[model samples]
Target: MIRAASRRGIRCVFVQGEDVMEQLKELIRYEPGINLEPVPCRCSECNGELRKVEEGEEAILQDKSYVPMAKIGKCDFWVCKTCGRVYWQGSHWRNMRLQLQRLTKSYH
Candidate 1:
């Protein structure tokens, strides 16, 4: 055990983890649910405002010269106008949206 004396003449005792539970339990409080705010459509990387990709900028979405042949799909996309980062509802982003839905529903 380590011992130390304070200037106020109080004996401060260091208690091990096993001996401190009873004294600490009353000060803890638990809440049953969490509160969440509305999800904003911003850049996941930089949180910058996202703008729709404009005409003639399709090259920014993918490397046209190197991209392999792919099946067709349509998804609404938003890109960060500042950093030029693209955002699309891939599986991970969709999963995060689902989690947000579950949390808001659970809290309500």
Candidate 2:
């Protein structure tokens, strides 16, 4: 399949693994410049650009239910410009950053 894609002038990085981290590592091995570090720059749902929800701009979210009231003043919030999906750095973000840090150490 990779050969077929290459014949059509396509670039590909083959990765196969059950573990998500392993697969990501494999991808990074082939594409060294790819940034695996977690950053709230794009929407996970639609790949839309994310803009930080500035102070006094939380009302633009439209759906208030998605906003975590407790984390409002605790962390920065971002909203997808296209899909309006809200994002915040919670526990998962820390875990992902840790994994990426480990992956980065292996490269160094």
Per-residue alpha-carbon lDDT of candidate 2 for residues 1-103, written as tens digits (9 for 90 to 100): 7898799998988889778798888888888778776778979899889999998886765457867777887788898999888998999899989988888
Best candidate per lDDT, number? 2
Cα lDDT tens digits for candidate 1, 19-103 = 3232222112122242223233677688678886566666666643332224113554567867767765566656766665554
Alpha-carbon local distance difference test for all models:
0.50, 0.84
The weakest ten consecutive residues by lDDT in model 2 span 58-67
C-alpha RMSD by candidate, in order = 14.8, 4.7
- C-alpha TM-scores of all predictions: 0.47, 0.68
| lDDT of candidate 2 at residue 83, scale 0 to 100 | 88
What are the clash counts of all predictions, listed in order?
Answer: 0, 0
